[model samples]
Target: MTRKKYSKEFKLDAIALVLEQGYSRSEAARSLDINANMLGRWIKEHQAQDDQAFRGNGKLTEEQAEIRKLKEQVRRLEMEKEILKKATVFFAKETK
Candidate 1:
């Protein structure tokens, strides 16, 4: 069977059902037709990140996004520095 993907809202609702609604994890999972283990994991994730939980596919958390952007900028600057170094070496040779 193909795996199912739940939205952030759905996961949050499921967690709320167990936490705020005082439903047992197994009860919530059975009522939602999802695995108990899945519900437990969702609860943990929701508790860990609260409003920032379940960012979905291809989406990054704020820290992750900032780190990715910084890494890309560092790569670009390194490439530019390498090119400049090569140009300086070539110019020095030409002046000899």
Candidate 2:
């Protein structure tokens, strides 16, 4: 068996292809010329880091923290809007 040499850019791109582009892990590994297992591990690690960073538990920038908070707020507001629309329809029907 031979050893594989992977660069940071290659690993990052492979992970992105598998994740962002929705490529299969095996396909990403084949395209990157790395082992599928290695690619999977990298993906898991990358996701962990991202999750932590988004939550501000990891070493993320202030901008990232703000973005994460804003995204959460948007989700909450959307849900509230949906609930309000449903309630309005229900009340309007009852009053009819």
TM-score of each: 0.87, 0.46
Per-residue lDDT of model 1, residues 9-63, tens digit only: 8988898898899999999999999999999998888889887789888888888
Best-fitting candidate, scored by lDDT: 1
**Candidate no. 2 TM-score:** 0.46
The regions of model 1 sitting more than 4 angstroms off are none
Each candidate: RMSD = 1.5, 13.0
Q: Rate the local accuracy (lDDT) of all candidates.
A: 0.92, 0.79
Candidate number of the best TM-score: 1
Per-residue C-alpha lDDT of model 2 across residues 1-96, encoded as one tens digit per residue: 986566556767888898889999998888767789988887887788754422323655778779999999999999999999999999999999
Candidate 1 clashing pairs, residues 3+ apart or interchain: none
- Model 1 TM-score relative to the real fold: 0.87
Evaluate model 1: give its lDDT: 0.92
